[model samples]
Target: MRTPRTAAVLVPLMLLALGCAPQNSSTATDTSASSGANQTPADCAQGKTMKDGVLTVGTDSPAYDPWFSHNDPTNGKGFESAVAYAVAKQLGFDHSQVTWTKVPFNTSYAPGPKHFDFDINQISITPARAKVVDFSDGYYNAAQAVIAVQGSPAADASSLADLKQYKIGAQTGTTSLTAIRDEIQPTSDAVVFKNTNDAKTALANGQVDAIVTDLPTAFYLAAVEIQHGTIVGQFQPSAGQQEQFGMLFEKGNPLVACVNRGLAALKSSGQLAAIEKKWLSDTVDVPVLQ
Candidate 1:
């Protein structure tokens, strides 16, 4: 774990590390609690949330799977949705007491007030982001994977250095794009799209030789989106150091400590693993790009 010279942050490590935890758009660094909780939040009062007696959660509309299922976060079928509820349960709210709100990916951490108690939209806990927003303990550690159509130049690559000649694509303002620049440093400028779907389309149409995304979404695209799609490979970012996703709260939200307690409970109880296994695929078999 990285220590910010100016901050007091407690970070955790995972033995099951692989791939780049390319987030929706930031490098990760923990900025959560430093102490433990009493099984659950000691306070469940409504004042801790955006709405009294309810836990207001925010995510982008059309929330993607396996982060969110059927574009309906209220159903709690996706990985993030399930984790949200699990954290809520630890915080003393049932599914009924939790509510959902729509937020744009960029607006969720733009350095102003937030509209939800916390947001779980694959946002990474970067030191830069932490300056403006508060993050719960990391809920998911992610990996980066690349996808390309069969016979494409990228699909033939065997290492990170081999990818330098291709045009890479990723959603605008996402850490996938950040990963492209920081990891690949391609000979040509990486292509930026409005969203993942657009990048997927560009790759399928041969507009870009390859696309980079979190490993799970890469697997999803290979399964259903790209015709004759193949996983080029997976790579752990920053030389195998783990990057993670955390629940976001408005800066100085006291509820942050409460949420950290809930996350701690999930980790200690093995509930977190169950949720992740149900939603995310194993990365053990994907070859490391370099």
Candidate 2:
């Protein structure tokens, strides 16, 4: 995903998008247990870190945007980058005390020891994932968007029922795939791709009517990746719940409580919202399909 260089246009649009409240009823699935109970963020983070005084973070390589910028995680310019630093600040680690390491997205949450204090790579909070690793409270609520080649039938859909006739596609194991089966419930079995690129290619080749992915990634595919791709619309993947992204941690790591404190403070103080506005503002324009 390409980061929008100009904040001039996207900021107001982002404000408008943020104004609409989510209709979903379910709360985020993962939250740190006893989040910093009886301890300050700094104290909760002490001695629990991979290093005594440094806050080590992990994210996948070639980090995409608008989550990361120019494939760099240390610049603190992208949404996740800025958020990670904000959390570190809340936990008392300054810029010079922080370090980043490469951790593949899947490996970051796998059942095993971890090499970083925390990992943030847009990993969603889910019951299954939470069983293996602890997660800070959700920092971003995500929506699924449909994308199709411009002028395709799927591009014309105005409602979920209108999409019932199409052969929808999504990457296997993603919430987008779950949306296809559980939300859209298309007439035919969905065309599951191995990854997002495969789904994008399928849409470009007219092998599938449409592809679904999180709204930000959908915007990226339509605006940057696929020359002819256009977003059809957006929707909450779960009918009554909004999907959310969380920072992952090793299970039983007390530092999760501290990170959650940072997220909580950022949310209440409006810094988190501001960071999201700066990076994800382009996502506001597409019509939302219910």
TM-score of each: 0.86, 0.82
Model 1 residue 76 lDDT score: 82
**What TM-score should be assigned to candidate 2?**
0.82
Compared with the true structure, what per-residue lDDT tens digits does model 1 show for residues 27-98?
Answer: 322323433433347363336777777899998875766677777899988778998998888888899999
Which predicted model would earn the best TM-score?
1
Error of 1 at 230 (Å): 1.9
- State the local distance difference test value for candidate 1: 0.72
Alpha-carbon local distance difference test for all models: 0.72, 0.73
**Clash number for candidate 1:** 4
Q: Where is the poorest 10-residue window by lDDT in model 2?
A: 12-21
**Candidate 2 structure lDDT:** 0.73
lDDT of 1 at 120: 85
lDDT measured at residue 90 in model 1 versus the true structure, 0 to 100? 83
Task: Judging by lDDT against the true structure, name the best candidate.
Answer: 2
Once fitted onto the true fold, the runs of candidate 1 whose alpha carbons sit more than 4 angstroms away are 1-39, 42-46, 281-284
